[model samples]
Target: MKLLVLFSLFFVLCSVESLKVLVLFHMPVKSLSILGTGVVRHLLNAGHEVTYVTVYPLKNPPTKNFRQIDISKNVELVANDETLTMGYVLEHQIEKNGAYQIQVFSQENARQTFQNENLKKLIQDPNEHFDVVFSDLLESEVYSGLAVLYDCPMIWLYSMGAHWQVLRLIDHGTNPAFTPDYLSPNDLPLSLFERVEELWARIRWQFLKTFITQPEERKIYEETFGPLLAQRGRTLPDYEEVMYNASLIFANEHHAIRDRPATPQNFKYVGGFHIEDPVQPLPKHFQDLIENSKHGVIYFSMGSFLKSNSLPKKLVQELLNMFGQLKQTVIWKFETTLPDVPKNVHIVHWAPQPSILAHPNVKIFITHGGLLSSMEAIHFGVPIIGVPVFFDQFTNINKAVINGYALRVNLNYDLPKGLSAAIDVMLNDDRYSKKVKEMSAIYHDSLTKPGDEIVHWVEHVVRTRGARHLRSPAFNVPLYQRLYLDVLAIILAAVYLVKYIIASFDTKKAKKQSQKKKN
Candidate 1:
């Protein structure tokens, strides 16, 4: 009997010391994304084992001495009109559809590569089990169900800046409305139109999610996962409750960007997750150009994956002509060689961005407003001229403008004239630098460093065994209840009763007067 008890105790201790977590990222390795690496690194810090199911294969994954496996990257994207048309139908049905559109689109691609059944089997096997799960909430439904199958808590990581998706999963996939600032009670600071815009955008997004993106995902889920489950009888869980299983959510955005009213408890902002070696020295030529150029050096980079050389030759020529006129030397991060060279400009295939930003002579940055680029620019107290192309770049540029450190020139806008003026504004104005400095302080002065904040919370969850204590009870309360519908209903009921009483008295008075007149 003593031996049996000792054996049971020994197994429990082993499991606690060796907790496994599975992280799924469905983007390219060079994409220099923020979420995948940050979460994996911190989980390891807390003594939790990690398995990063990479979407794309690498000749070498970034980290050393860590477990990394490339899941098939054959994700089927549902972006074309052919696929989007079906998603339009789903948008018409599901009333809650904020993240559904992108969620469905992105996840469908991943689903095609790795069948859902494989995920379940991985979870259910006794030898291979996870104590907790952390997933980017691009598609909460799929991962949330897996969390339920494992009977564990899930943590959501928002890849992009704060949007409605993170809130949806944290509210247990019930409210469908995402809180802008998880800490504010009122949506102050946003104009009435902006609030309305967010509402309409979410409503439209909800209906399109399942229909357009996951037109066939439901059937796929049942076919692959139904028979393998023990309690679910070979079926999927409720979409509304799928994310209630999440223990906490870690957002890449912070109160610096998303500080607004009516926020949620689940938002833990650990911005700058992709902060690479900030100390790497700049290349010698790049360093010399910035230091030697008599006028301040202006740096132009559109970020990785998008090549500046791919632009029309006409556009390239226009840029080349503009560089010849500038007193400052221009360093364009270009993929291909330029036909005409100007003494004032230099072109390189790749430039260490942070190193250049830190350089004393770099005066202005031209960017696509990717968060990392924008943040680095601000970190150095430099202003930006943004030409946002697509995706969250638009949102990032919009916020930078709102915060007053940057100006956006639309990609489709007349580039030569518009860009020249934007550059002039950054150069002439001292206010932009002052504004960036203010933002830098706010971004850096939070109670905890973003990385440390992330590590602390991750440890908090593990220590508490998924920490339900941190959850907010607001989701269980319905909208009408939140808005005091019962009180309003009572007031409305009383108004009708008073009207009825007044009408009864008037009718009696008219009948008695008529009787007296006849007599």
Candidate 2:
């Protein structure tokens, strides 16, 4: 048995082969950046050459295997989009502006990045080539065209849950009965109306994508890649085929976090690949602070996209007042300092989130329930008080609550009381921490490291020359066929035909009887 195990390990180590890879992730969000960077780092460490195109570029300790095209200027525009501020998002702009606006903005960002002189030059070079293309599954399909341009397989990097929006590219869409919409806040066992609404949301999003977004994306694809393809005397690939022919999707999802029933085989869960093992040590002052705290510490942060300082002043003061009443020292990740702060409260413009979470003296985490934050909290085995602001944050927080490791408080109502209650529950009720610790054990129980899985699968796809066997046939099946609507149509037509024939025979019999009576 020992000899067999040793042979298997040797085979696995020897099977790894280095190849060229292209990474296109133009989204400016921090979580997406971290996820993309993790994949790039793993591939580069395995002796693979990479060309990374992104809005957030690598800054230090540059390696020869990696080449970067920095588009941080366009990323700045996206981050500072006037409508995307915390104030606007609080006013429900995310829902009101809808996915359509989001798609338009994403396309605009992609267009700008692809048109950059540096990226254009990369495409113009005849010597440039890659074995596979890994891209962020943002709203744009502009990057999917790269797979066709390079004549290689494509793998989508889904930075969050399995959003129904991209489900069409892999397998059929998930059943709305159990799978919640990305924009919805509803929990499972949805009410009849909520179920109908969820279905409607899918239909609505499909309509928008089909009629509105895809056309624009295709145009961008043609404009961006058409000339390049023509220069090589190749025909432009079909937009739908390019979009749907992904070899695999590496989603940042885990059953321990969200229990999904019917995700496709090609969709691999590699959620915590970005989390650090043997987490980095804290800065000296922060370490001292955590060590000196006698009553333990409550860490508060509102992830990256939303500015915690931009929250209403009234709510901030109310939260501070509530924190003042607690025995636990409060460490808040506020972007700015507050005047007349409580003696027990410590404010930092920026906090080392993972380091702080790893500290033994931290008792509970009050968070915005972003996926990265939630995963980090679980990684460190800390219970949570979730304050969900928008989008999938609501669903993530609710899942945490259902998992028994969290309590949620809405950002809109009863700020002080709700926060205090959630904090109290997390700190006093030992059950929350205990449950989270159990989950943390399950989270780390994978047979191989998530990073190794990523590199192995990426190599597998290249070794098999596209790993086409892993893809689902559902991508080729039309929506009508997948829903069995065509079968339903035939059955309904047969029933109507039978009823018509029977009614005709009955009419003839009645006519004959009347004729005999008259004679």
Candidate 3:
């Protein structure tokens, strides 16, 4: 019994050995940072030492094991630029200019990140080591070099749903026929025209990637990581190889909320990982306003990237006038104060979005249809009116509309009447609320909480030393072989040979008949 007890204790200690984790999540968006912080928090709770590189640092470090390398100034230089804002996106429709603009911005951001003094120090330190590295799978692939620097496995964290760009790294690209591109405004069961459009969109993106994006990214990759790799006496691998070599990817997606695609074993869905458990109570003023409201409330916010004050003055007045007609109290997340505000319309420079969605008196949510907001609405069982502005917002809102939980409103000067009509439908019809509640139940029915799943998988990769067994075999197969082009070539050659031989025989027979007739 003494020997058995000792063995059990030994196993326990072995299983819980603290791991050194390095995290890089430098995206300027606050929502993406929320997901990254959640990951850092869970790793710290599991007794792991973490070195986090982020734009949004924690106000107070959670523990001594947690260390942050602040890169907010570097990211802000790119993020605060006016050309990348929501107003710019709306002016130049995403189909034409938004994607290219974002790519350019991401390239500049990557350059700035490599130049950050603190990040440079960390990379140059001879004593720095980590058991694993977690990096954001945004447009830039320069950070993957850190995994190579530490000689540890890399895992990618995607801030949105399963996109073809991310999936192509793990497995074959998703078929554009059925799976819409991330920027596409259409969904499944697509019409013939939609499929053609989707295919063209994909081809155009691939063309841009091959001709424009990849070359620039490769240059940055070599310029930033070349010295570090040379110090280690190793030549850099191909940029494609480095980007596609991740051991696993944790996508902010769930089959419950989105359609399930053919994902590989390495692609794990852990959506809503940022939502706090035992959600904190609202502040006194917010609680009082929500609880004391005579009529239910309607919440409006365009998310962090788009400022409500950026709207045209005429449209703003139209919205105010529309809100004045509503009997329900309106809570708008505007960035600045406006004059002549309606008594029922309350304007807050900032609002606690999740807390507001959780309130029982909140009847409807009018949003910009960001994935994070859509997920939150579904999480709290609140139906929404989505006003998608750009990027994946169109796709996310379309999914909600197809799922019967949300209505979409175009962002235009004439949004007031349209928004009011959608609000009426939401308030009068119970179907949207009931459908959203059902989705909420599904979102909550997972076997393990998102936080637990994150920790388990992160440790799993570290314990298994990259977990290569989980990777798809498709990675090893060449495109020609996978498409059976060689087999098709062989069959075509055999058919041509048979036809040639038959033609020769027929000619000989015809000549023999001619000789007999002459004789």
Winning candidate number (TM-score): 3
- Against the reference, the lDDT scores of all candidates come to 0.65, 0.83, 0.86
Residue 440 local lDDT, model 3: 92
Best candidate, lDDT-wise?
3
Model 1: per-residue Cα lDDT at residue 16 = 64
lDDT of 2: 0.83
Stronger candidate by lDDT (1 vs 2): 2
RMSD of 3: 2.4
Q: On residues 299-367, what C-alpha lDDT tens digit does candidate 3 reach at each position?
A: 999988777876777788899999999999999999899999999999999888888889989989999
What's the TM-score of every candidate structure? Answer: 0.79, 0.92, 0.94
Q: Candidate 1 on 210-304: residue-level lDDT in tens?
A: 46654455555545445546444545665445645677877666566643334466667677655553547877877777788887999999887
User: What stretches of model 2 exceed 4 Å from their correct place?
Assistant: 1-16, 90-97, 500-519
